[model samples]
Target: MHILLHDFAGHPFQAELSRVLARRGHRVTHAWFAGDTGPKGRMARTEGDADTLAFLPAGQDLRYSKTDFLRRRAGDIAYGQELGQAICAMKPDVVISGNTPTEAQEGIQRACRQTGTPFIYWCQDFYSVAASRLLARKLPGPGHLIGGYYRFLERRQMRRASRVLHITESFRAQTDAWGIPRERVSVIPNWGALDEIGVLDRNTAWAQANGLGPGTRFLYSGTLAMKHNPELLAGLARAVTAGDQVVLVSAGVGADGLAARAADGTLPGMRVLPLQPFEVFPQVLASGDILLAVIEREAGTFSVPSKILSYLCAGRPIVLAAPGDNLAAQILRETGAGQVVEPEDTEGFAAAAQAFRDDPAARQAAGAAGRAYAEAHFDLERVADKFETLFSEARNGL
Candidate 1:
């Protein structure tokens, strides 16, 4: 079967799935929005990749401004049109899309319907919900109305999708509200890219380059968008045990805010750097004694922050600031992989950091637990089998 898998943010594990499907004798073309300045995994064909596997970088030259609503909307429309063209050209049996804007998703699904192809709505997060909150903040008066239109489009897309693949079971409450059938949706949680990321110690060359480590480095390595609070990051920097520093690898609005604070001496000497290349990501991750992730309370449900999963693969203890009910937080609590504090709990977040830094044995244990979780969850063979089954079901007109 020919498959088109489009993860707009160009995430790591999604691309890995494309490789696995191709190895299973199905042709898979993994596509992504190359212009997004987010942490990406191996999107290119490796020497070991099968000929059936390929990569397509959609909108490699498009201008994407995360903070500008109108500009982003326009970019989404353009990307959607380009992706629709790819759909017609590839003529794949089924297409799976995630990390896509509502407008783009609507367009892609319409293209699938027009071409008589099955479309899988990979529900990584609720884009319409996020857009609504962000838009409301940006445009006070007509924001809800604008968000309502996108929500309408999203509902239609959901109702028309061939199948909805969700990353978490909690999404059923929302989809069920849309009156989608129980069988039409499936929950397959996201996993870390264990195949590509190897375990590295903290004394690597990456730490040397950064002039940071061999000591405790708490790394927050993901999208620090509107849903994230830069103040919490600043609080983290101040809260960590002295001699330990916090690293923020991000871009866009949050990056700007953090950089400003760092410059003004308000951020307490935290390292605010732009997103690094994926080639050094493993070492970058390794430089951290405790990995970090943050999401605001408003974005607790709408944002999953897959960086938590990536941190798990790094064999590092995590210090996450999010809602207790958030899936990532729940996982950390259940697995003892790391510590989770409330998004607004600056003191607790700091305490968690200090505790981890002070106790090497406990940190090592948490890191071990995290790696164990990654190993158990990311069996590529089993994962590919599930995708293949879904594709076959879609082909059978299920």
Candidate 2:
């Protein structure tokens, strides 16, 4: 079958799945938004890749501003149109799309309908719900109404889809509320690139070149969005003792602000760097003494930080600042991967980071547990089997 996989963020594991499917004697085209500035995967086609595999750009190189709703919405629509044209032209047997704006998803659904292709809604997050909250805050009076329109569009598109794959079971509530048939939705938790993200030595060339390691380093490598609580990150930096460095390898408005502050001496003892190339991602993760992640209290279970999964693969103990009920926090609790502190408790978060920093034995134990969990759960072969089954079902009019 000709399969088109559109992952808006161009994440690592999703691209790994595409490679697996391609090697299985299927024609697979992995597509993503090249303009996106966050962590990306092995986007370039390597020489060892099967001839059946192809990587294509589906979104334009327009200025991507998350805070500017009007401009972002226009970019979304333009991307949708471009992706739709590709879908129509390729006329693939199956299309799986996720991490997309609702407006762009609508266009993908439309194109699938036009081409009579089976469209799978890869529901990574409740984009409508997040957007609704964002719009409500941005346009207090009528923001809700505008947000409702997006919710309606999202529900309609999911309802129209042949199958819907959710990244977390928390999405079950929304799908049930959407009145989508119970059989149409399935939960396939996201995984890390087990083969890609290996555990490298802390003193990797990348780490040494960046002057990161040989000392206690609390590292964060991901999208540091507004909802991620930048102040807590700053608090973590401030609370760290002198000679300890907080390194942020990230992007997003919040991260940019933190970087600016760090540069201006307002936020000290922090080294902020842009997102690094995928080739050096393993070294980037390994350079840290302790991995760090954060989520606001208001976020609850609405989002799962994919960084946590990747961190597990990196065999690093994580210090996550999130609510107890948040899935990532729960994973840490279950796996004994690292420490978890309430998102709002700056003191607790800082203390946890310091504890991990001062105790190498504790860090080693926690890191071992996380790597064991990753090895047990992040089975690419098993994951591929399920997706292959879904592809067959979707192609046969599921």
Candidate 3:
């Protein structure tokens, strides 16, 4: 099968999916906005460069965030038409896109209609107004207006698409709120990108580079985005008892604010390391005694994060700071591999951290469980098989 994949966010999952499909003998072509913060260079078509399919004309990039929905623009329709032309030439067996804003999705759907392709919307991020309410709390009038407009466009896209690949079971419930039928949605949670997951001996390097000791290492990797309440981890760092140290290695531009928060002498046991290439993530993760996945308490948190999958695959115990009802927390409970506490409950997080530091046996047991669970459920090869089955079923009109 020939597949055309559009990922405005360029998430590693998209690239991992493409590689898995290619390995399975499918001709997979991937497209995305290179500037997207998620995947970075992982999905580049050529060495050191983004794929031409992901290229966007200057001043025409259609970015959609919580605040982007209210501003109605003609550029969206133009971008949609442009995408339609690109897919028309591919003559793909299927057209699929992930994390595309509704405005861009409109264009992709129109393109699929024009090219007679089966379109699938893979919802990694829920662009619901509830997300804005949860994160921003008080959005400006313009933001609210944009949110309303995008929601309407998303509803339209749901009606047109052949299927919706959701990152969480909760995502389907959210889409159903917009009237998408049950048959049109499928659940495929995020999986570890083995291509991105490689070894890095950060522990040995940390001693020479940062003069760190063999303290119980708690690691925080990835971006310092607003949704990621890393400050909470910093706050909990002050409560670390005995020989526990929190090592924060943040990447990308989003780390600036988090760095500032960490540097203010607010969190005693925490240290912020500079960003490194994405390739070293697995090694950095391996150096840690526990991995911290923190998110703010809010309505939209039921959404799953890609980091949880990566942490699980690293075979490290996870100290997740999210609502218990969230998919991340639920997965932890289901796997019996990690501990989940409510977001903003710094005392709970600190206690969990102290308990893990004191109980090595318990930590090892949980870590082993997480690693096994990841191998069983979140492995790229296994996930790709499920995706291929879904694609075949959708194309066969089953």
Candidate 4:
């Protein structure tokens, strides 16, 4: 079967899935936008194993802008049309869409219907909810109106999908409210690249070269957008005591904010860096003493941070600032891999970081537990097999 996977944000895990599916004798094409500035970036379009194709439309930029709402909306509509055209051209047996803008998803769904191609929605996050929260915060009165428009598009696309592969059960209620049948929704949690990320010693040359060898480092190594609270990281930095050699290393959006704060002498012992290449991600993850994950309370259960899975693979104890009932917190509690603090509790977050820093045995135990959990539950091959079954079922109209 020929399969096409579309995601506006080019994810490395999707590429890994394509390789796994192709190795199983299925032709797979992973299509994404060229404008994603995430960790994968251009590498997502260029690197893939044999029998798997990475498709990025030439000269197409679909990155969203915070300041230019009208321009961003227009770009999404244009990109949606282009994306539909591309899917129609491929004419794959099944199309899977994940992490797509609502408008773009509408276009893909419409194209699939017109072509009689079965398609599944690999629902990673609730886009309409996210847009509503963000726009409501920024635009006040008109945000709900704009968000309602996206919600309409979201409902149409979800109703049109042959199957909805939800990443968490938390989404079931919303889909149920939309009148989607329970049988049509399946819960398939996201998995980590256990093969790529592994336990590495902190004494490696990469750690020493990057100034990560001398102190207790708290690292956050993924996109920190509006859904995350950067001020929590700033608060953690401020809470570091004089005797503690705690350092904060951030490599994404929070890094930019923390860098500016450092320049102003507000965030001492904070080192901000650009997102690392995928090849060097293991080294970057290993350099940290404790991994950090944060989510805004407003995002609630609508989004789950995928970085937590990578942190699990890295075999490091995590300090997550998220709601207690959020999926990240639930995973940490279930796996015994990390500590979870409320998003607003800066002191609690600092305390957890200090405990991990001071207690080597506890940190080692947490790391080992996380590694064991990843091996048992987050294996890439296992995840690929689940996706294969879903694809087959969708193609057969099951």
Choose the strongest candidate by TM-score.
Answer: 2
lDDT string for model 3 (159-184, tens) is: 77888888777777777888888888
In candidate 1, what are the lDDT values of residues 273-385, reduced to their tens digit? 88877788888888888888889876787678898888999999999999887899988999999999999988888889879988999999999999999999978778888
**Which has the greatest lDDT?**
2
Q: Candidate 2 at residue 198, lDDT?
A: 87
Write the residue-wise lDDT of candidate 2 on 342-394 in tens digits: 98888888899999988889999999999999999999989989999888888
Give the least accurate 10-residue stretch of model 3, judged by summed lDDT.
50-59
| TM per candidate | 0.96, 0.97, 0.83, 0.93
Per-residue lDDT for 56 in model 1?
A: 91
Ranking by lDDT: 2, 1, 4, 3
> Total clashes, candidate 3?
5
Worst 10 residues of 2 by lDDT: 296-305
Q: Model 2 RMSD to the real structure?
A: 1.3
User: Which clashing pairs does model 3 show?
Assistant: 69-146, 70-145, 70-146, 80-107, 200-283
Q: Which is the better candidate, 2 or 3, if ranked by lDDT?
A: 2
Q: Residue 165 in candidate 3 has what lDDT?
A: 83
The per-model lDDT (C-alpha) reads 0.86, 0.89, 0.70, 0.79
lDDT of 3: 0.70
